[model samples]
Target: MDWRLKRNCSMAPRQLLAFYLSLCILSLGIATMFWFQGARMIMTFAWIELFAVGLALWVVARHATDSESIVLRNDRLTVEVANGQQVERVEFQPAWVRVEPAHGDQSLIELSGQGRRIAVGRFVRPELRSQLAQELRHALRRWQQGAARPSPV
Candidate 1:
């Protein structure tokens, strides 16, 4: 069985662009009205609001690409995590990796072996972390069964 997991991104680039365009048009219209009313302070407030909104949207957009991708193939279990611009990857021999929760009952899945470790399931709901862990463990077992390499230490 092949295993892959990723976060559900809520926004797309086209949607984000449309949102920005609409927001800009609305802000310009409102600011224009205020400008014609002799309220000069409105422009500063408008700019501040635009900045705030842009910053907030940027954060949401950045997170849209944030995700965890896992693939188990060819005796290797590859894990990749994308958080904004930074991405972390760890590869392990399927026979040696252990999958467990990071904490007691409610936490992310921690995959460890060969003195290396990586946490996953952050995109899954807290209540479903256990289920995700179970799934990973099952996939690991399947991968190990078909391997012909020397036993893991």
Candidate 2:
């Protein structure tokens, strides 16, 4: 497969941060108005709400960088998976790798070879996982055939 498959989250990190900041500011602004009106209980509620929002944003931020990048180039297949703070990278010869589903036919695609196993197609919908596997198989087959051809003397 002469292709690069990148599956990143739909929301960017900056966008998520900006949304969290803007919403917090807006909510706090309304709370400040209520606080000045002598409704002191509203202030406590507002603080609680702020804390809740912050927690939610923290969770979202953790997974904001989740992505999978699979690149096939120059007789090498590179698979990169990023989840939160951990990242995994593995390389395999296109001709030696095998592609299949990790579980059922609808499950995630697994590419294994040379003592390494990598699962891809998380960003793809579950229904399309089989399709993705088929495509990967076709690409690998083509790559193997091309690599096996003899060069002209």
Which number leads on lDDT?
1
**TM-score, candidate number 2:** 0.84
- lDDT value, candidate 1, whole model: 0.82
Q: State each model's C-alpha RMSD to the native.
A: 3.9, 2.9
After superposing candidate 1 on the true structure, give the runs of residues whose Cα lies further than 4 Å from its correct spot.
147-153
Report the poorest 10 consecutive residues by lDDT, candidate 2: 1-10
Clashing pairs in 1: none
TM-score for each model:
0.88, 0.84
Q: Give per-residue CA lDDT, model 2, range 73-135, as digits (tens).
A: 666889988878898999998878999888898888899999999998888888988887887
Model 1 Cα lDDT, one tens digit per residue, 33-144 = 9999998888888888988888888888877877888888776888988888899999998889999888866788899998999998888889988988888887777666
Q: Which candidate's TM-score is highest?
A: 1
Query: In angstroms, how far off is 99's CA in candidate 2?
Result: 0.9
